[model samples]
Target: MTIAEVSKKYGLSADTLRYYERVGLIPEVKRNKSGIRDYTEEDCRWIEFIKCMRSAGLPIETLIEYVRLVQQGDETIDARKELLIEQRKQLIEKMEDMKKTIERLDYKIEIYDQAVVKKENGLKRTYD
Candidate 1:
């Protein structure tokens, strides 16, 4: 299929696909006789994985490095696995940070509610 078809399949814009290719985040695409990009099933799968990893907050440079490692073939298998594992650890840390943020917000909200209640009581006392 072409770039358009691949973009439609993955819900990504054609420009984004081109940018990914240009940035070396994605491998070079195969071109057909018309010089249009010809995307294959493997390309689609790779794009999907990229989208997932990106959504999970993986950096573009990391993805690019991972792709480079992958291109190195079997020799870099362990390195690739380690990279993924490290990324997973970072994701967990981000999740914990988010959890802490939420907890802090909750605590602040509780204090705000107490202030509101106190204000209401003070108003009642003033009226009395």
Candidate 2:
């Protein structure tokens, strides 16, 4: 597929795709005779993997290291697993932090809701 097709398919900008390729986030995309990018299935897979990793808040440097290890072949399998494990741990920590923030927001909202209800009850009594 062309870069445009890939961009549309993946919901990423063409420039982002090109940037990913340039930064080694994904492997080099194959070029057609006209020197335009002709992404193969394997290329698309890499794009998907990189996009998913980025969505999970993985750092670009971490992804680049993972890709570099992937290019180095199967000898890096254990290293890749360890990298993924560490990233997963970080993601879980971030998730916990977000959960705490959400709980705090809920608590604040509940307080406001109770104040509003109390004011409404007072108004009702005054009108009655």
Top lDDT hit: 2
lDDT of 1: 0.89
Residue-wise C-alpha lDDT for candidate 1, range 58-115, written one tens digit per residue: 9999999998898889999999999999999999999999999999999888877777
Which model scores highest in TM-score? Answer: 2
- In model 2, the runs with Cα more than 4 Å from the true position are 123-128
Q: Give lDDT tens digits, candidate 2, residues 1-128.
A: 99999999999999999999999999998899999999999999999999999998999999999999999999999999999999999999999999999999998888777777879888432211
Candidate 1: deviation at residue 48, Å?
Answer: 0.7
What TM-score, computed on C-alpha atoms, does each candidate reach?
Answer: 0.85, 0.93
